[model samples]
Each structure stands twice: as structure tokens, then as C-alpha cells.
Target: MLRLLTRFIGLLLLAGGFIALIVDGTRSIAGGRLLVTTLNKGASEFFPALYQGLQNGVSEKSAFLWDPVFTTLLLLPISVAFGGLGALLIVLSHKQETTPRYWRR
Candidate 1:
């Protein structure tokens, strides 16, 4: 029973870890790069408009515009971090056997 429970828990953890690793890897590779490109273009195009908008908002004093793009961009870092941590946990939980000498140099 204990063995079964352990295996069940391990399988769940393994699956979660695999997901996190994929998310982080994808963010770090594709998502992060895309964000960098998007931000570069957005900033270049919008700096003047952004400054004027900020000035107007400051005068209004209680309104703000949140960008979903920023949030998504932020997630790329968090996903990568969580994924790395999950991968580490999965790796640490593995019960590795001693490598056979025949398989070693």
C-alpha cells in the first residue's frame, strides 16, 4: 500500500515537473525572445505617446491602464523559474541505482 501510494505521488509529481519544465523551456526559448522583440517595437513606437499618457494619468490621479502583454511577458520569467524548481524536485526524488562498472568507462 505504501509503495503504491509512493508511486502514485511520484507519478503526479513527475507529470507536474514535466509540465513546468516544458513551460519554462518554452518561455525561455520562444516566449521570452518574442517578448523582447515585441517590447522593443512597442517601446520605440509608443515612447512619446506613453509619456503624454502618463502625464495625463498623473493629472487624473486615480486611473491606470494595465497591459496584458506586460503580464504575459512577466509570466515567462515566473514560468521559467517554476519549471526549473520543479525539474530540480523531480530530479532529486529519483531513486537512482548505482551505475554498473560495465556501463562505465
Candidate 2:
């Protein structure tokens, strides 16, 4: 049950990432330049208050974490971040077969 749920969520995130990629590609083509939407920009646009709170919370915990780690993560392309995370979750949740079909009796 949990595995199914995880895969479902992962599929949703992957779809979202694909949609974002398409939008970014369209914008870049129209503007005649390479353009990418960073995770920070997308998060802030969608959830301004939550994003601000996350920044504040991280900053309060550790300046180094906020400046280097968090900022670096936030700077990743939104599509990459979401797609990578979704892919990871899907892979992690996958069931492994112990026996090969050819070896089965």
C-alpha cells in the first residue's frame, strides 16, 4: 500500500516537472535565449509565505546551511529538482525480484 502511494506521488511530481520543463522551454524559445526557472523562484511564486518561513527557519538554524547548502539546492532548475526527486522516490520504492524468471522452476 505504501509503495503504491509513493509511486503515485512520484508520478505526480514527475508530471509536474515535465510540465515545468515544457513551460520553460516555450519561454526560452519565445525570448530567443536560454532561460530556466530556479527552484527558489518557483517555490516563492507558488508559496510565498511558506518559502519565506523555510528560509527563516534554515537561517536561524545555521548561517552556513542557509548560505551554502540551502542556497545551492534552491538554485537548481525546478524541473531538475522535482524530476530528480521523483525519480529517486520511484526507484527507491521499486520492488526487487530475488529470483530470475529463467531460473525459476
Candidate 3:
């Protein structure tokens, strides 16, 4: 029962993580739409300011690039680990045995 629970949790997290990535990837497209809307409203300065700040940010002190790299690297191993664990669980799941249960002949 504990094994089943653990497997369930692991699979759940694995699937959830994948779903989050897909949803989060849509942010780029959504952001483009937001930018267009903002520019149309004449609130155009904020976006360029944000972009310049990102560009001028200190690489080591700020999260502009390094953060994404670090986050990506961190998530990559976790994703791979979970996937492998799920696969191992599937491969190791019990199968019908060759040995027969004791009973009347």
C-alpha cells in the first residue's frame, strides 16, 4: 500500500510538473498581447524601461538571465529524475508468477 501511495504521488507530481511547464510556456504569447495592449493605451514607457532594466542588470546580482538558467538547470534534473522513477516503478510492478499457489492438486 505504501508503495502504491508513493508511486501515485510520484506520478502525480510528474504529470503536474509537465502541465505547469506547458501552461507557463504560454506566458510568452500572453505577454506579447499584454505589451500590445499597453502600447495602445500609451503606457508604452513601462515596457522599455523594464527591458532596459533587465539588460542593465548585473548578471550575478540580478535574475535576468542567471535565474532562468539556474531554474532551468534545477528543474531539468528533477524532471528527469521523476520520469526515471516512474519508469522504474512501471518496470518493477508485479507480474504473474511462474510458481503456483499451494492448493489441492
Candidate 4:
């Protein structure tokens, strides 16, 4: 059940990543330069208040964590972040085979 849920969520995120990639590609073509939306920019645009609050909370908890770790993550291209996460989740959700090896048989 949990695996199913994880896979479903991963599929959704993968779709979102694909859409973001398409949008970025179109923007880049139109602008005559490479354009990519960062995770921070996308999150802020989608949920400004939530993003701001989260940023503030992280900064307050530990400036080092926020400045280095989170800043680097948030600076990644939105498509890369979403696609990477989705792929990881999908891979993690995969079931292992239980069949015995031929040598054991």
C-alpha cells in the first residue's frame, strides 16, 4: 500500500517535472537564451507565504544549514529537483524479487 502511494506520488512529480522542463524550454527558445526556473523561484511563485515562512524558519534554526545546504538545493533547477526526487522515490518503491537463485535450487 505504501509502495503504491509512493509510486503514485512519484508519477505526479515526474509529470510536473516534465511540464516544467517544457515550459523552461519554451521560455529559453523565446528569449534567445537559456532560461531555467530554480526551485526557490518556483516555490515562491506557487506559494509565496509558505515559502517565505519556511525560509524564515530554516534561517532561524541554523544559518549554516539554510545558507549552505538548503540554498544549494533551492538553487537547483526546478525540473532537476522534481525529476530527481521522483526518480528516487520510484526506485525506492520498487519491490524486490523473492525467487530463489538457480544455484540454490
Tens digits of per-residue lDDT for model 4, 4-62: 99999998988889999999999999999999999989899999999999989989999
TM-score of each: 0.32, 0.91, 0.33, 0.92
lDDT of each: 0.51, 0.92, 0.51, 0.93
19-58, model 3: which lDDT tens digit per residue?
5445445654777642211211222244667645544564
TM-score of 2: 0.91
**Candidate ordering by TM-score (highest first):** 4, 2, 3, 1
lDDT for position 69 in model 3: 64
- Cα deviation at 55, candidate 1, in Å, is 39
Q: Give me the runs in candidate 4 sitting further than 4 Å from their true place.
A: 100-105
If both were scored by lDDT, which would come out higher, candidate 2 or candidate 3?
A: 2
Clashes of each: 0, 0, 0, 0
**Full candidate order by lDDT, most accurate first:** 4, 2, 1, 3
Off by over 4 Å in 1: 32-105
> Lowest summed-lDDT stretch of 10 residues in model 4?
78-87
Tens-digit lDDT track for model 2 on 51-96? 9999999899898999989889999998998899899889988999
15-105: candidate 1 lDDT, tens digit per residue: 6555655654676687556332233343445586885575466546644333443335433433343445555555666666777677575
